[model samples]
Target: MTPSYGVRERTAPAYGARWSRERVETAALRVLRWLTVAFFLVVTLVPFYYMVLLSFRSIQALLLAPGRLWPSLGELTASTYVDVLRSMDEGGQGFLLFMRNSAVLAVLTVIATLLVSIPGAYAVSRLRFSGRRQVHFLFLAVYLFPSIVLAIPLFVLLSLLGLRGSIYPLVVVYISQTVPVSIYMLRNYFETVPRSVEEAAAVDGASRLGVVWRVSIPLAMPAITATALYVFMIAWNEFLFALLFLTEDPANWTVSLGLARLSGSIEIPATVLMAGSVILTLPIVVLFFLAERMLTEGLTSGAEKG
Candidate 1:
């Protein structure tokens, strides 16, 4: 039985309608994805490019041509960098000391956070202790709380102890801020490790701590590295606690606080401040690129199993 031509044509239009809709939707989504990528790229890269551009140009050039993207060869100078990095005694901004302070605080926070979090994470992941589940809630509570709220009590405690002007108090505050997240990251990775591996180590006369240190830790090194980097970045970039604790002591100022303080000075050049910003941003960029691969692997290690 053959269908009539008119009827066949009408059915053909109906059959193609669903496919046409799907094609339209798919193409729309593809275009939307590219637009999103381009938007974020501009949002993220443009500021850093501008910062670099301004860092190379003098204040006079920038003021005269505020919209210029590139500086002429005659206008480019490294004096801004020199002024930012040299000591105040040398008539510079003394950002070199700020960088040193930031590095010390970040490194110390990473170390201290890891020391507390690693064992705590292992215990939560591997042990069957009383109130183990509730511990995570405690961590979540701490992590969810605003830092500004926590800062008040911390500031008062430090002041009472006469520790307000030292870097050590800032390190302690950062440790509190970072340890909960560190424990969470490490715990997630540690749970993915097979218990059989630790049991095997134990069969060889290794103690519980020995199993954690020698067996489990070696396996979770990637996650541990990622967590350490995360903690370091947080501590390095933190401003509020640094401001509260170290603002009274110029010698103790971290790079973030120093750059902020520089902004308020009418005598300092904007180009020099921009150079200081570049210096402050450079280490984080370098560290991220260096550890990018390890970080990726660590973050995605257990995804396939789920």
Candidate 2:
């Protein structure tokens, strides 16, 4: 009987033998990962979907069915977009002007920041000048200061220079804010470029500038594009500076400033506010999608190798 019991015990498999501890853990983690992804996707997309839905909905329909997630086709219209985009003189919110101002500031900031940062980053990376290591520390220190600390001084300086309420001064401020970060980013990318490539070009009678332009610039285009997009978004959405400088003149308002004004006012409709939000957000979304590959490469640059 004891021998028979021993035989029965040996013949029966151990409990949970097929599903080992590691296997159970792995399965749990896989399910948890998918659940986390789905939660975040819902969190991110639902608001934006509601926003787009509200933007298309009429005020009457919105008030009638405030909780409705889906608006009827008949209730949807582009009038909200029209209202947001049309000029104040045309009895609308005048986002078109705001868009233009934001565009100008963002474009100029991108250009100026890139122009300065590229050379600065290259010098910091490739050259052996005195205080070379300290330069990056200075850039980091400048960026670490709260932007609010710079705002009042900038406002006063712009006043003295008679540049307040002008997009040009806003561009200058953005350039100051963006250049250090741009240089930091570009420097990382530039450092990744092999010296052999530059030396080859230089040996072939190309100047130092030619070697950089022909070799480094092309190689760093992904990073440059990412930096430009970063600067553009900063300039486009900046509120404190825009408020400090441009609040006196509605004509000079960037989209962010205008949207802020709208949000603060009781008279503006929620639908219109949603429309303005879409207007402010849509360009960045479109631009990001268009350059998704380049941006991914740029962000991941040097992450593994460096």
Candidate 3:
């Protein structure tokens, strides 16, 4: 039989075209992924590196060499840290008080948020009630609203109540702002837990509260830890609420507000402010890394089954 060129030629060209296209797409995607990684690494690290470098150099050195990336050994000093951390009466910026205030507020907020959210989340996930759907909607609404908008009304209310500048009111605000999201996070994890386990505990003569205390809480410990860390970071890094509430009272200033105030003064050196920024950022970085694994597990614990 004579060789048929039509079928063989057409089929060969189509196969070749598909193979070439796939190879081209694969190579392009590989290159793009590396580029994206490099871009993010540079974006995230360069500013932090610059901040540390500037923090160690003298104001005079930075003024002399504004574009320099590295400071000479002779130009490096730790006085900026000392100056930023000491009390105002001691001829420094008084960041020690700022750190204390920030810590107290963050801790209190975390505690209060967890206290309210754990039970609230448990109820939402496990109970049947008339307003259950409405409650979920309300939480979603609050979470979607801009905090600044709510801050205005809260500021007015606090002022009327004579609690405007107090850290106590800020704690209340943080709890209200964070609790909705906290409940949402915890509720999802609660739903993932098997109800039979709770039933088994009940069969063993466990009271409702006892079952929740021993069974639900223990099962959701990872999510709770993650939630607490999240709440702490939010409260620690809060600037808008802190400024709105505490700006008039210098003694109540958190680290975020303190660093901002420092930047507004002509007398304060940039290097000293950079040092303050570093101090403010370090605790958050440490806490995040410490809880990172638990947070990851908590968030992904139920994903496979879902």
Candidate 4:
């Protein structure tokens, strides 16, 4: 009554085939996921690492070994940072001046853009204004238009008015470029706020402006903060206008323009320029991470409500 050997062998082969297919599929998915994540990490992180790595070495090291990923401790140098930050009269790049100018211009642009865009967005969202639909179309059109195109007129006007090489005109230009998109972003977030809360505030004798300031502003703080961060980053990283407007006056040069101009010089080492770049990039990175948490929390809270 013993079973035949072929019978047992046939069943064993089928079972093994099933198990093999399952193992292969699982392994393929795991590999795909890891590959995707690795690609993202490399793309996002490699540039920052390179900036830091290059910043710590001299141009001789970089030129002699352009392919090196990490600098040896013996090659490490902090003199690049000092050389970049010190004043030109002291035989340095004078980037500290550019940093101050950029900070002033970016902060002023953020303040001006937020002041105008906040009210405009609220009006468009809450009021029964005529042409409300066309307003959004106009904002979208303005955003889509090339900054280079606007640069031509702005450049000409600033030159004619003796405002070229000054920070004032650059601030104006930054405000124009940022305000439209800020309005659009703030408008979407405003629309998401419950109308009932505003109505309740109105019942308590709050005026339209009061409702916006007292109720809407507090409720929409996260979105407002996110939009401010967005505008701040835009102003901070702006390069073309900064170059065109401020290149003639080293006193007015932004960090971006200064870095570009300094990097172009044959006498300046690439590592020193890289150090300047890291100095320029660090603030924006810190701000983005801080604001990212607030943005996600705001968006997730809205999503949960629905």
Candidate 5:
């Protein structure tokens, strides 16, 4: 039998209305999610793309066509990058030296921060010590302390010790800045390691440190990797401390300091400044991409089946 054009649902009117409401909500949420994603993508990529485009062309072309969003092949010039990356002796900005210094400082900070924070975190998590429960608060307190406060004392100390212009002193400062937060993050991951596993390792004649190195570290590798990446980026992009320490010594300048100089120098064209910015940005970008897999990996994935 054919149904009437207008039919009322008698079995469950409330369920029909509720179901319609839920479907509408779900569809609306899905559209909102895509719109949000597209918005962020545009906000992030457009400025970076424009900066990159400007770097590939001459300042003359850019000024002549101020509103041009894209450039023709003939208008594009690689000289901006050449000047940015070349040595000062060759009448260029010498960013390669700056990049090298930054790389050294960042790598050293990562290593030293990991070394100090791992044991500190493990002890806070596992050992019975006075104020162990409250240790995290201290870490947070240290992290919350203003950088300027720390920088003043550190700068004075380094200068007194005749350590100015050396990257090692900067490395030490970065280590202090990073280690507290690293310990804070690593502590939680360390606590998640089963005491039984550690006990078994101890029963097998492993020392406390050995168990940490052999068993706990493997389990918490994902967290360790993430913390390292975090610290690396902090050291890589840190400007205030780098500027305070290395500003007087151009040879010891980091990418951040070099970029700052480019920005402040009127003789340096905006295109050249953009090139310096891209150079400063590339290492962190590459590192993030390389560690993206490790960052997303679960700490306890292999320990249990979900």
Candidate 6:
């Protein structure tokens, strides 16, 4: 009997071949994943780096050496930031006021959006209301509607009311834009929460409002944080309504509108505008990181499936 290429030898080759194929595929997948991650990081981070790099250099230096990626230590200056933050009366651009205005609008928008969205989301998620199904469709339609088209009507109305150049209108616009999405995100998370927990609370004679306040809100903390941060980012980065409403009043301009307006001017340096871009982008990034941490910690708590 030939022992060659029989049962024992064939089994060894088969095992080796399958193992080799699996190892090769796993290695390829890992490489692909890492490559995709690297690509994302570079795409996201390079523009930020360029903005910071140019922000530290003078307009003269930037013009003289537009292609340079790194500035010499001596070329770096705090003058750009100083010029940006200083008052217009002091011969500076007065972005500090713009920043303050933007901050107030964003904070107010966050508060109002969450206040309205939380109860709305809770109602939609828990209670079997008459218009329950239609509510989501309405929210989706509002969310999907073109903001610019809405802006046209808003602009016309505000202009007629002589409110076009105020931050108040901008805040209201931000809230309207944010509320639909907030309700949607929060409702999804609210639905995922176990109904049994609320029923148990109800058995203890807790009212609907009491249950939401004591039970649902606490349990949905992660989703709340995420929603608030999302609203904040939208309000902070909002440009169209800001431009439409506040462009006439430079004194009341938010950082976004201010940067956009100045971006078109021949008198302002590109490096200066780049500095403004960095300033505009920094706070949202910090808030997002904080929100990400909260979301991670929230998900792992009491998430064991039965």
Candidate with the greatest TM-score versus the true structure: 3
Q: Candidate 4, overall lDDT?
A: 0.87
lDDT of each model, Cα atoms only? 0.88, 0.85, 0.90, 0.87, 0.85, 0.85
Error of 6 at 235 (Å): 0.2
Clashing pairs in 4: none
lDDT of 6 by residue, 101-133 (tens): 999999999999999999999989889979888
Decide which is better by TM-score, 3 or 6. Answer: 3
lDDT of 4 by residue, 82-182 (tens): 99999899999999998999899989999999999999989888889789889878988998899899889888988899888989878888888998878
Residue 165, candidate 2: alpha-carbon lDDT: 78
Q: Please, what are the lDDT tens digits per residue for candidate 1 over residues 195-219?
A: 9999999999999999999999999
Query: How many clashes does the backbone of model 2 have?
Result: 0
Candidate of highest lDDT: 3
Report the Cα lDDT for candidate 5: 0.85
TM-score of each candidate? 0.89, 0.89, 0.90, 0.87, 0.85, 0.85
Cα-based lDDT at residue 159, candidate 4: 88
Stretches of candidate 3 off by over 4 Å are 1-14, 296-306
Q: Where is model 6 more than 4 Å wrong at Cα?
A: 1-37, 293-306
Worst 10 residues of 5 by lDDT: 1-10
Judged by whole-model lDDT over C-alpha atoms, candidate 1 comes out at: 0.88
